[model samples]
Target: MAWWKLHKRDKPGGPAAGGAVLASAAIITRDQVRSVVGRRQEWQAQGWDFYRTVPELKSGIRWAANGLSRARLYVGRIDPDGSSAPVPVDAQGGDMSPAMVANLLAPLEDLAGGQLGQSEMLRRLSVHLDIPGESYLVGFDDPASGERRWLVCSPSEVTSTGSGGTIRVQLPDSQSARIELSIDDCTLIRLWRPDDEYGYLPDSPLQGLQDPLRELQGLTAHVLATVDSRLKGAGIGLMSDDVTPASPQQSDGPNPIHSDPVTASLIDAASASLKNRDSAAALVPLLLRVPGSVEDKFKWFDFAAQLDEHLLPLRESATKRLAIGLDTPPEALTGMADVNHWTGWLVSDTGITMHIEPKLGLICDALTTQYFRAAWEALGIPDPENWACWYDTSDLKQRPNRAPEAAEAHARGAISDAAYLRELGFSSEDMPDEEEQRRRLLIQLATTNAQLAPAALEALGVQLPDVGQAIATDAVRAPVEISRAEPAIEAPPRNEPPALPIAASAVLDDGWRMACLDLAARRALARAGNWLLSRSGRSRRGELGHVPVHEVHMHVSPDQADLAQMLDGAYRDFHAATPGETDLHAAVDLYVRRLLLTGIAHERGLLAGHLAAAGCDRAAA
Candidate 1:
């Protein structure tokens, strides 16, 4: 499987015996080399086609043909040097699309006579090359659909015109007369077998392979003969010096088992028992009796092991010769390669490189120059001369085992996500769409920004609402220092006399709590009012209970507590006096400070019990 070159032809370098440096043209001349096929002298009408006569030739041709048939053909462009690129082709007078061309090349429906698809078409060409050494493909433009159609015309149905550069084809329908087509109108693909100019029909590959084919056939016959001789006792013989006639009378004293009927009968019964049952269980011994006056012997005629002596090397040489004639690997023809997995793969890779690529290049180039370019122009494509037909042979090539390597490349960013998926044999369509990916990105960004919102607001001289001291510290800590401004506008003057101030010694412990509660209540009201101003159009947080901070004080009638009524009246009047003082940022700062103080006081077990009973609970506030 290492694809070793078995034999090399001798080079022309030495001088002849007469001291003349003779040059030979046998290998180069078409007539001299073409004589090797011997088809001109071979008998016809024997129904012995070239491919069917040679089994190895059949397999090799079929293998190469199937590989070419599966090739992916597309509308493309090719350079004069034979390099190719993909190009767009219009279908049915529509915009540039491969639909029309691809369908024409690989149709879902058969083209004609059940042989129109790419695979079938290529197969027919392969068979022709094997049998007749030439293939022809005819193309026509369908006027109705404005598309080009092609069919593989059997080589047998086509006969060349002598000295005219044209071929006549027998139509499939017998009612139609034979139609002559110019060589320019059809694509001709053939191997490099030498032939004449008029016919251009190279002899079949089988012609060159005659020596090997005959050798293989002879070996096969010997093998069958050996098997038959071993299986049917054909090689057994009896040696006797004289012929003796059978007598009706038995001998008087003793007789041979063959001469005595009773003795022969008893011996036949014992032989039957030995054969029908186990020899050990039957307890029968095989015996042979001969007359004393005569000598007889039985011998096994093992016709010399000539078959075994020559079978191996002859088979190998024959296969090698066939491979050489067909330009194929011997392993491909014989399937007797002693190679490990790696070596076998190397040989397969070499086959693609050495055999398949070159053959495909020839076939594709012919199709491109003859059919594809003209078809493209008919579809209204500009600059159609540059375009060509291309076949992608990746499917025919054996892919390396590179799953882990592809994964590593993706992880290293050496390949894109889509490319990685393709390498892993997955479709990129299974991944999320662009819009869905963008939405997910936005949500992630918003969540991250929201978590850092407090710091952002603080940097701009704003603050957040405080749930409690512990909760506030857990959520976000306020800046160590902040600039504060005193209230700029004073309350409007009242019509009543001002109350006298109390001395410091007269202030009670609960008085500080009362002041804190009153401050917290006023700030909360200002914050709510500021929120309503900025977010007027949005829905309010009504389900969160929406209780006011100073609900208890406001609900108490003026007749019950003159002090509470006076404080409420004063704050309400001040709030109404300076409506511009209710800034959201200022209200937020005040609310956070009071809420922290209230939480710390409650933690010290001094405010909670009375706060709820006094109707100033934190939840209500």
Candidate 2:
């Protein structure tokens, strides 16, 4: 939905009173605002966590498209001041090495393919990775002054992409660069290659620029309102003049999976259904990831959405659900006295943003999966099928002498959630029921869930309605096939050796295809003899199977690292010097550069019989 249309708090100016049209998809929840307005409040209070509501789908268009279009960014001395001059993003004679530049461009490549821009784009800079206090410097060649200056990547852009993946941005080229980009799980850690014409080069800065915050130019109010806020609220303090607008050289090119007839039709149908709302632009991309990311971690991208999220809480019983990640620290839940209640939130560096609303139906299965895991472990439930019994509650609660109305919920032969009890099974009649006791029990029918959350609306004192429409309705009939997935079966070892993924030039039909196969063969060679026997091989392609141009790298160094670091820094300079890259395509290019530097692609070629084969021969010798 449009940022203006989403839930807005009543401010002195009114809902979106000062918001400009350029602020289209950008919207923060009242809770997020409450963070800036109420920072020191000490989430020390019970259930006082936070979450930044991300758009269901956001494109990484160049930052300039929005009100921040005029924003000027620069290298820094640090702080909110214009004390530093804008950095020069180019080197006169030194060329960054191609390999290092490839490392830098990995993440940018992903950005281009994914369709992110400006506020929309930067909002996700650190989505998958985090490297606080680290920075990348760019040397710009000032054509007019003939002076070179250096700019440091601000905290806003240097944030992380979770999963240790790259940022995916394209390298700076004079418009005609033929860079095709796509992401594959294996390629994530390898260096990417752009079209042959363009080459990588490296250069270092002679000096650094001043921090933009020091300039504060008419932004004292915003800065103070935002000083303590971390990366999340950083952009808020920025005036339209403060942000470094996205260069169009960045953006994810186009949807490749959307080309599939079934997938394409699904997106088209979904698009046709919601054509009336312009803000629903990202819906298509959100749906496409289910079929994309070969690695399930990529599925987290979908969790970064709003549509399915908003409706999740509503689909289940109002009873609270509790979730505890094995990795979460007890410190995170400091003041939360009641740990049994249902709690969900978006996790990130700034902090956790708790989701207060009920979830929709689509995500119910996912939630059940997460929480039921705890249940399965609690009871001696050997198999998942045994856990299936937990979802049905009728058996424990139903008994003789119960009024017809009492049995109405289960009378239809549905697998009612004996919502009445779980783990510690209990029945009304067995406990010598009384009307008053039953009334109290009626109010909290699902005793099993009591352990799951506060007893009532008044109990925890959460400000939601008590006697209202039932939050979750009766379970519906299954429309689609609901077959349970089989457990992963292990593959038995085989004695046969592996073969390279090869291409008959005629069968390949194109150089790109030939290139992909050649790369695959090279990969096989790299990993040959490293394994025992038979192995499976896979290939990744973008658009019509062409290698995209972009890179992403994650590392912290004083000035530079090795050959790769020098090159990544060089091309990052190239992107800053170039302009007009605020789109999904450019985001991919940027990722590409970083990916190359990180050496994610270069490693993919070492799977079987390729360059990584020496080890097997060594073992035999």
lDDT of each: 0.46, 0.25
Model 2 lDDT tens row, 90-135: 2112454544333222222322132223223222222211112112
Which sections of candidate 1 miss by over 4 Å?
A: 1-50, 79-116, 139-150, 160-207, 226-232, 235-308, 334-338, 416-422, 425-621
Number of clashing residue pairs, candidate 2: 192
The best candidate by lDDT is 1
RMSD of each: 21.1, 43.4
Give the per-residue Cα lDDT of candidate 2 at 15: 45
Candidate 2: regions farther than 4 A off: 1-135, 142-145, 149-311, 314-621
What tens-digit string does per-residue lDDT give for candidate 1 at 301-414? 432233487678988888888887775666787675477765676777777777666666666666665444434433334675666566566666555667899999989999
Clashing pairs counted in every model: 0, 192
